[model samples]
Target: MIRLSMMMGRTAAWVACLVLGLGAAVQAGTVDVYSNNVGGDAVVGASPTVAIGSSGWYYSDVRVGGTAGIDSTFARSGNGSVLFQGDASAGSYKADVSYSTGESLGKLSDLSSFSYDWYRSAASTNNGIQAPSLRLLLGVDGVYKGALVFEPYYSLTTPGDVATDTWVHSNIFDPNMYLWSNKDLPFQEQFNHDIAFWKSEIGNYDILGVSSGIGSGWYGTSIAAVDNIHFGFGEGPGTTYNFEVGAVPEPASVVSFLIAGGFGLAGAAYRRRRAR
Candidate 1:
């Protein structure tokens, strides 16, 4: 009976060690991009600029024929308004907000997954016509690297079109179907394009740029407004780090697990000897 009790104690100790080791191994990281707080406010400038609104939201502006190269007008009902407006020209423009190396919530070194919530509004005339949709780009260092273009199936018609607001989540690691079309083109072609873009554009950069106004032909005498831009990393589709747990296992955990396993085996052997 004494031998059995000793064996049981040994077994329990081994199991406890294993559990503790595994628990230690569990580590995680997170990256959150929001309009109101953090350093995510907006890149400051005239026309093609960003700022925080009285409502505590970030606004971006795109202007026409401005030094900022943005041909859009940005406005807001509150203290902050980043405008993207122009005088009925048809071209493409880009704007960006960058998070420095360690500013992100989780200090995500690698962009794993990304998601955002945005609201869109148009100057009441282009209801039936298709206006250019906003495209999201991820940059590294200071270069225009990779892009995640989202084309809304819906059209912008009126100002303050609250219905157009929605949350979009995507994995950076997965294939972006919205950017590539699969018809007669082979699947590999799309993959290659993405690879090239990511490698050249986002491979080692830390900045994230939000670009709008692509394609040609603009609806006459109208404007578009976007607000509440949010980017979340580590929890979404392609986010690298695991926000729920941590991105990778700590070194200590691996060592602990091995030690625990050794203890368990040793305890088992001791029990067998005692039984004999």
Candidate 2:
């Protein structure tokens, strides 16, 4: 009788701990790219260093890194906006965001989808269009493998259009919205490009770049104002969440399940002993 009593007590305590932990440790998560509060003192692509959100980062390309900043005059949803100004000379600049898991670095493959909002006013002096782009880069242990490229709708054609100043939402994973640079076109391709690298054995990173001279046409001033960004994990109508720059996921969920299992086994043993 005492042994069963002790077991029941132990199980009750374990269940209590789990319930408390879940309430205390569970966090609302979201990967926010930029907002009204987030801005920088320097212009993106032209400046060597720029602010991503609250924690700022550096930017540099093969040619040179430019400036990136937040714009107060224009904003879609928030009071402020993030702006990237193109450099006079030709070059591409990229700013890498820091995201990781408990054991491994977070890669593009970790998330099912990512999206952002932006407005662009650009013109191409050269034959090709040098525009700002977002990418999911894949590499093996460190060596570069490939990237999933996303180009804005207005930037694809030769003659650049003046942005209506209204904000637009773009989901990079959606086949209709984004295009792959090295891979074959979406759906119709004999092979899937982005998926291949994303599922590869190596780790990958995410990069946001504002290019000057490059692809289809070279735009001297690809003046762009961007805001409201999100990276989704198993994201959909009900499963998505949002997190800031510094926040990280905790292991409370796993612990909760384990504790619940222990309680179940203890209760079963108590019932069987009582019957006997």
Candidate 3:
């Protein structure tokens, strides 16, 4: 009887360890970053000038005069950095670029959620004002054919005053508010719209696009810096099973364990009755 109880305890402990190990595997997540450079311009699907800063960070320069019409662009820095700075124009100076990872990973689907810390220099009257805007775009085959635009909640018009780099988190799931109220649909809807638009415009091709430009304008008036751009599929932190992992255990294993435990307890009870 003592040996049987010890065996049962060991079995239970082993089962618990296995369950914990499997749980950890399922909860794993991954992050990747792409730095915009001149040589690898094709990687991002658009050709933009590359600028190497003194800090050793490669920046994509899309000046308003360039073929791609970007003043300057930098997605990820050399150290896997997430800081970005650029200028935009209301009329002519616009930086349109896209980053793609191709496919989704289960429920994490594509980057359905995005959060970034950003701030803009006050808009300048002489060198154009920087009323910075934020936009999220989706890419397919390296092209940004469309986007879902987010309006500028904070505008900086004062010179030398820095806009606070507050972390802003947004989920592109509210279609009614995003599309109807803001005159723009959610990210998924925007993607669908671009697909139909592309079918009509380019015929039989998948639509690759973005969420929208945060600060859009002409004349290099809109200057802004952004950092910590995080993209993920499910909800951002603090929710049950928000980022759950792996498959459930086999039903047979669970049933077998239950039956075995019950039998062991019954045997122990019978022994006690016989002794009494």
> Total clashing residue pairs per candidate?
32, 22, 26
The runs of at least 3 residues in candidate 1 whose Cα sits more than 4 Å from the true structure, single-residue gaps closed, are: 1-61, 65-86, 89-113, 117-123, 126-134, 139-142, 154-177, 180-207, 211-219, 235-276
Q: Which should have the higher TM-score, number 1 or number 3?
A: 3
**Per-residue C-alpha lDDT of model 3 across residues 13-63, encoded as one tens digit per residue:** 766776666566435532222333423222121335333222222223343
Q: What tens-digit string does per-residue lDDT give for candidate 2 at 156-187?
A: 33445434446666666555443354432123
lDDT, candidate 1, 158-254, per-residue tens? 4333343222333233453233322222232242244335435334544344444422344334334433333444455332211011122334665
**Model 1 TM:** 0.35
Full candidate order by lDDT, most accurate first: 2, 1, 3
RMSD of each: 15.0, 11.8, 14.3
Which model is ahead, 1 or 2, in terms of TM-score? 2
Q: Please list the C-alpha lDDT of all candidates, in the order they appear.
A: 0.37, 0.45, 0.36
Query: What lDDT does model 3 reach?
Result: 0.36
